[model samples]
Target: MSQSFTTKRYRRYTEEALKDALSAVGNGMGLREAAPVFRLPRSTVLRHVEDTTQ
Candidate 1:
């Protein structure tokens, strides 16, 4: 017997919201501080910052 594997991709925020979220970080904020304010995961916020810079 063979088993099939699947993965579910995470839902992403809108581009405009993501941009605003990261801008807060650029203005000397932190993921911990920003996440709660935006009601998002810290990792998600950090990833947005990293993605925009690249």
Candidate 2:
């Protein structure tokens, strides 16, 4: 049987972009609130913000 596969493309945010998102959240904005403005996932921002990865 022939099978077809599909892939989902994700947006790659620059370090500066992430920093902006982090700053927004740090400045008292919520994840759900900031994510849409930055066009990123709330969980993604959370991962970068909560983790020590650079």
Q: Which residue runs of candidate 1 sit more than 4 Å off their true CA positions?
A: 1-16
Tens-place lDDT digits, model 1, residues 15-50 = 666667788889998889887776677888987688
Q: Poorest 10 consecutive residues of model 1 by lDDT?
A: 11-20
What is the alpha-carbon RMSD of candidate 1 to the true structure? 3.5
The lDDT leader among the candidates is 2
Candidate 1 Cα lDDT to native? 0.79
Query: Cα deviation of 7 in candidate 2 (Å)?
Result: 2.2
Residue 16, candidate 1: Cα error in Å is 4.2
Q: What would the TM-scores of all predictions be?
A: 0.60, 0.74
lDDT tens digits, residue span 1-54, model 2:
987988988888777777889999989999899898888888899897788445
